[model samples]
Target: MREVMGECLPDVVRARQKKAFGGVQGEWLRKYHKRAVYGLLRSASFKKREYWNHLALMRKADAFFAGEGENSFFLWQCINLELWFRKFID
Candidate 1:
């Protein structure tokens, strides 16, 4: 736990931010890149998922499309979706 780690090793909590450690892949993807990735996330088929919030997801992908993000991990989701469709739905 972060709280426990911080209590045991205070230095780590204050340590300068380091890359390659870890974070949400989706957040990273939305922040870093857009164009090629948007083909799937914004695809009409992807939006057909009844459980997902389509507009909100589109806004995030649109940010990348418009070149707002600095880096990204969202592409993986797109890739995974495509592969899953090919395997199970296609």
Candidate 2:
């Protein structure tokens, strides 16, 4: 995960420089990451999808946190999860 994020950091930095950090660019990035995380979670050869379940639970926790108070944290979690999925899946 660190390696993938490291590789993607350049592009993310570029996007920030271009002020393309939101709207469509942001949406696309989010989707890409979500897919990558999902793929990673699904990659284990084990019978139980533990990683996938853990990720899902984390997402739910993020949602709950957002609802309770930490809106930014929730959004960050969501974006992180999506990015994770995108990086791993593709």
Candidate 3:
């Protein structure tokens, strides 16, 4: 797909990569990392933080897992935030 786009649309700066990568990542997270995602989001450290309401965040997480919307990016951000806290603050 990228190769075809790159060949046919030389001027189009390969923008499809972002969308493709995001799709792959979102699917990957749902299929392979669901447990890890839930574990991180539901961790004591994560919930104790004041940055977000625990219930609200859990609701969002559940919705994301339920395919409520295109919330993969949001969940990805939450995962990164949790990891960051673990690395630097926790």
Candidate 4:
């Protein structure tokens, strides 16, 4: 789509800077990492069978809140997996 736009647009338009889209959730999560810490810590699935290092999750959460975490997408995946297990698994 960007290529098509560049081709169709004038050289002047094409020369302008391009911005990356979609980081609203990442921004929000970073800003509100403290609020999410409790939920991450309360992971039942994460506690079972050592599938994931529970302490590592806490460290990641801490890193996120401290603005040192660069793996927002991975954190989100971990959260989703925990939620999914709670919702679907007996």
Give one digit per residue, the lDDT tens place, for model 1 in 1-90.
Answer: 555677676785646475676556656555554454676666777777765677776776666556777334554665576668858985
Best by lDDT: 3
lDDT of 3 by residue, 1-90 (tens): 766777767655765445433456688888899999888877899888888787887898788789887788777887898889889997
Residue 66 of model 4 has an lDDT of: 73
Clashing pairs in 3: none
Q: List residue ranges in candidate 4 displaced over 4 A.
A: 1-22
Q: How many pairs of residues in model 4 come into backbone collision?
A: 0
- Go through the candidates in order and give each one's C-alpha lDDT: 0.62, 0.47, 0.81, 0.71
User: In angstroms, how far off is 87's CA in candidate 2?
Assistant: 0.3
In TM-score terms, which candidate is top?
3
Point out where model 1 deviates above 4 Å. Answer: 1-36
Q: What is the C-alpha RMSD of each candidate to the true structure, in Å?
A: 6.8, 12.2, 5.6, 3.6
Better of 1 and 4 by lDDT: 4
